[model samples]
Target: MTVTPDIVLVLCVLLVVIILFIIDRVRVDVVGIIVMVGLPLLGLVTPQQAVSGLSSNAVVSIIAVIIIGAGLDRTGVMNRLARLILRFAGKRESRITAMVSGTVAVISGFMQNIGAAALFMPAARRIASQTGIPVAHILLPMAYCAIIGGTLTLVGSSPLILLNDLLVVQGKSYEHFGMFSMTPIGIMLIIAALIYFYLLGKKILPGCKQIRERGPLSPLLDKTYHEVGKIYEMVIPENGFTKKSLGQLRIRANYACTVLAAYNHVTHKRIVAPLSEDELSPGDCLAVVGPPMFVEKLARDFGWIYKDELKVFADDLAPANAGIMEGIVTPRSALIGKRVGDFQFRRKYGVSPLAIFMGHEITVSDLSVQTVSEGNALLLHGKWSAFHRLKDQNDLVFTEPIRGEEIREDKATAALTCLAISLFMILVLNIQLSIALFFGALCMVLSGVLSIDEAYLSVDWMTVFLLAGLIPLGLAFENTGAAKLIADSLMHMLGVPSPIVLLASIALLTSFFTLFTSNVGATVLLVPLSMNLALSCGCDPRAAAMTVALAASNTFVLPTHQVNALIMRPAGLRPIDYLKAGAGMTIIFLIVLVAGMRIFF
Candidate 1:
């Protein structure tokens, strides 16, 4: 098989994209845009096909799914589910690990994995703190569970959606797997992960001594108060700032305090990360953090009650309740390149930036002056419920546990019902998945589960655009014989004797490679090639495609994955830590993948 010039150019672009992703020098979406624009210019794919993925039903469905996830988040349904699951974890560290692993996995199948993990992280931390489980032991397993949980349904993961879409593009829509088609194998993989982590995998985990974490963010408390800053809270009287927006008050500038969350004395509810659009009502108790003197002065001037200890800031703690936690800034963090005071951290994110962690240096007390940079972790304080505001944010990930009732069952029921209707349409009515998802998103808004603006904000435009951009590369591969070339390369590397062996081999390869690059990128690059491999080998394309899709989520081995990175700083992880536990888990999962394929496929 001759490799055409088009194939060579496509392969070169693919290599460049992979390298850029691994190096962390450029953003993933930017890298994808390069491929989207480059492929057509290089004449690898026609201009029409290059932009086709942007309007594809697959991309549209994913956008709808993201909005639905947001509705679940705003409604607090997922959080309630997480808290309920946490009840079964028990006091034993091993039981806690098993339950957390399985719980997040199961819930993740229904919601976005990141959102599921976000709600559960606080619970997991609280469990670890109370039960004496090592934070390291719980965090990695939780992250892994989130990834595998998405495998249970086609809607559960991006790779699954992309694979099905690819099948449609290839005129194999009839053979596309159903919503629950991946459930059997997904359950098997999760069971294997939990069992391994519960028994044999426990030995590889760092002990409480090594992690030195009594609470997820406890180790950072000293730096928070003495180094970063201390926690503070203020109450807003109906007459003081009534009906005023956070933007109008200029409280952060006026009193030098970042407003974290507002507890309504009348409503008995705490609004976390209240948006600027939100008006300050009478009886609103705002949690703020600033210098002791400044906080006191602000309290006096506004005729508001100020609790320097942050007790009243906590929703559960009541008129006198408050608390503190840690939040890590990522590469593209909105909080970066600005001092905690200047940016009005608490006003913006609904939490005070108490301190910043830069490499080996920890700055706590003087955080207001120091500019935050990428990779810096900010320690914050406020109500546990207020922490939820931070969860919906994209730039930073919080480490502190959010205690008590997570999901608001009343509102959540509406979102869940909408999701059920969408799933019913896809599985029972055989409606186009994209159409069902779109209708579900609409229902969420109409039911008041989320406002239209909230729905728009909830979508991860980066993921949507990334999918749109990189998907055309798959078309290029198929068109230029690049897919066949890749298939031939793999066939030569591992001779195709039994189709099962070929399937397992492809799955194994995808699993290993996903540890290095974004799972979505890996999936987009390889799934088309896997389909071609199946056709060339006279094997089942559906089975081959499903294997590759599931395998793309095998992102347990490294912190390169977003879920892993989110937990790493909080867990105090090292590279070898991932290797010690992940290797065993990976090997066990490979066995399960092979067995599941042989039995189910």
Candidate 2:
């Protein structure tokens, strides 16, 4: 093969892109955009070709897949799956780890692996709290399995979904892969991972101490707000404060007491974070958190019956349903410079402000009147559902991971039907993958499973644009004969190795590329090269191209992968920890990948 000026320029651009990716200063998506614009500037690809990736089949399919996943999430399908896993997981650490990790692995075969890992993270933490296992032991295994599980189906990972497109662009006689073409090898890899973790986890996994079984966030809440106040229940007498709304009494303003929940004994009604206009009728029970002296004074002055224990409000105000949480006001929050009372925080957000930790000061009184600022940590008490809603908003961010019943359980069946329709179209009807998935996503929006805004919010636009921008780079590799140049160089170095050796080498190279750069970048850069290499060595080009696609998901030795980074902060994991576990997993991944390719393909 002859190396030309176009090939040299393409290689130079590729080198710069890889260096920029490794430097980690600029965002990966920005690097992708650089590739998108840089190639056209260099005249390596035409303007039309440069922008072709934005409308490509792979990018469209990924968008649809994300929306479909969100629809299922909104309808509580993942939550139900988590519950089913817990029902059978038992109390053993190894069993729980295997069950959760395996289930996530299988789920990742259909949707984005990072999404699958995130969906199961809270469940893994819940299991760790219940089973006396350190979350460190469970999270890494789950993350690892999720990465491996992406190999199960074509649409499972970005790389695999982009494979057919790259192959066709190679303009070879290669056939496109079916959705489940890689399932046999993927199943083998998943089983191998489960067995490896179950057998050697205690020896190799991190040994971080377990948090309190009550839930990790509980202790943090107690330590931070222990000085704020104590929870007390009070009952209203027959004629005490009759027909007077809570606003008229001005309890928070005068007494520094916040009513968290109200239970009416006569109507058997429970209102959490009751509005200011809610009337204080006789025989109503109030769940309030305040200073003991202030609470006693209110009881004495108003002739209200006081109780040392929460009897009627116990279930309503239980830790599982309602508790104190720390919420940090985002820098771009709408609430900035405004008082908490300006937005009617209690009525709108369904959370009561207990104390504001601003700078070094902790303000407990007149919380509604206190001005809000960026990064102000507000200690709030409310139902988990309220915190969950706040998480969706950008103004206030919760510090702790919350488990709440926020899913629309009523739309679950509709979501499932939509998913079934998508699958049927793909497997039976033989429709285009992107078209089938998009139709399913449209069904989700039309069926009231998810609002249009929610569907749009579900997409990680960065990933979409990254894939879109990098596609043209792969086209340049093929169009400029850069792929052929590199393939000939590699073939000369290897001195005509066997077909299996060729496939293994391609897998190893792709695995290394994905660790420093992104899996998507690695796939786009290598698929064309792999096809050329296979042809040069008299090997099966399809197998070689597939090798590059599958190996892209084998990045576990670093925290560079999205799933690894997602779990790192929560698990208190460091680089050395990933190296410890990922080394063995990486070796196993290669072994299974090579052997499975030889046997299956």
Candidate 3:
């Protein structure tokens, strides 16, 4: 049969999702909302049905889980966990590779994989810096692990939620997957990942072996003898304080300074906890700890030069036109594919690249020397006017990029508590899952885990609005007989009478679609087709729907398919790194999923 108005409308919606995914003109959530509401308005579905998708327990559960993940992140729990991992990682490449992959997998199973990667990227970078391991060696494995972990349960990702909803609507009753159902498969993937890393992962990852050599510990660490107070570095001028003893100069009494370390330029030897009565020589660099005002005054009065290289006293600068600006690198920005060193950013903008807070960790060195990637955050330090000017440049990507301060201890705690409540609500309390999530979100505010403002920030309102908007279109696909028509066409193509073949066909198509589009969008497009195919083949539609849902979550081939791609740059990964590690795992999971469905369904 020819395509109907309803079918045409559905195609148009799919086109929009694809276009947005390719060009990234708007947030994915915004696109989702447009398809959802616009389809119903075009007489595709009723208003009530359109709005009902927002109430899906699966959506609520996923959102609540994000809040919980955020809380765990804020309390320094994830960082603490990462630090522990690094301690055990030692210098062995094999051991470090395995632990990093295992950690990402475990965390991704419980929380959002994207969030898990974001939390660990900085820690991973720090560990790489300390241990002399190539960051590219660890990052791709971490991203793949998160993707694998998400496959373990229905609540692990958005695609799973869409799958669960599609199955429920298909009239087949299936248990919501356990929190760890996919763990067995996930573990197998981890083993495979370890093997890949040991063999090819180390060799193909970009960046010099010299980059893996351990560097000296941060200068600040070596300079500070005490941790309780602030430390400042001031250079003693030849005439200002030459040949004066600490007591003679009354440096402590005059400037409220406590000497932490004294560096002799001639000898290059650092004296930690220098003696109070020690004579200050010309050109001596002293590390002093005290209040900001006192430190600044001491520098000004003593004619001491200020050093920015030492973070110990870097924060004590005279606030030289300093302010924070947040921006996201657009796909089209000059930084899209350049390395940090390629740009010589410091010399160009007079701004030092501080810490990049992205879905991955782009370090100061990377920003200074390596090529830049899209969606990466560049934390700039310079005069406020310079920052404002740089921000206004066209080739730069600047939008609602999240600030570092947003991810704090309280928000992290709130996110964790919300997860706990969501777990109780989903597995134990047996209350309506959506209500449970809403309550959990409420607790984030009430219990001081997150302020009202912060709680609002934590919510991905675009996703919420998009899901709410898309739900009606999905319903319309079912109600308008479009689903049945598509199913019949697919069944005729398969030309096999077996339900198993039809199920596999549906799944394969969904997985293939997911490689290029949003997993949620893939599910919305194919769920109706799968249901129709199931009915035509005289099988339970829920079984077929579940297969497609599971397949949609299996995005291991391309970094662009999920949030995993965003981590590639910081990890210093090459394209082959993903293909080598992800290709094999994708095949394994696809096989396992088909076999599992045949037995379980």
Best by lDDT: 2
Better of 1 and 3 by lDDT: 1
Better of 2 and 3 by TM-score: 2
User: After best superposition, candidate 1 residue 264: deviation in angstroms?
Assistant: 22
Worst 10 residues of 1 by lDDT: 313-322
Provide the global lDDT of candidate 1 against the true structure: 0.69
Measured against the true structure, the TM-scores of the candidates, in listed sequence, are 0.52, 0.58, 0.51
The lDDT values for all models are 0.69, 0.78, 0.59
Q: Write the per-residue lDDT of candidate 3 for residues 195-256, one digit (tens) a residue.
A: 66677665545545735321111233223212213445778777756577665765555665
Query: Which candidate wins on TM-score?
Result: 2
Q: lDDT score of model 3?
A: 0.59
Error of 2 at 487 (Å): 2.0
On TM-score, the stronger of 1 and 3 is 1
The sequence of per-residue lDDT tens digits that candidate 2 reaches over residues 1-601 is: 8888998998888778656654657665677688889899999999998888788776787677668877776676765554466568656788888988888999899876765776677556645644567888989999999999999999889899888888753454568899899999999999999999988998788877765334213677767766656778889888746668888988887787888888877888878889888888888888888878888888888888877566565545645456778889998998899997786768777887788888988888678788999999888888777788877788888888775546587898998899889878975787876888899999999999988998898777776666677778777877887665664576578767788788878888888767644577678788877787778778888898889999998988766576776676567776567878998999999999999999998
The alpha-carbon lDDT assigned to residue 49 of candidate 3 equals 71
Q: Give the poorly placed runs of model 2, Cα more than 4 Å off.
A: 90-97, 107-147, 150-185, 195-322, 325-382, 386-406, 496-503, 509-587, 596-601
Off by over 4 Å in 3: 25-29, 48-63, 90-101, 104-147, 150-419, 460-473, 497-504, 510-549, 555-588, 595-601
Candidates ranked by lDDT: 2, 1, 3
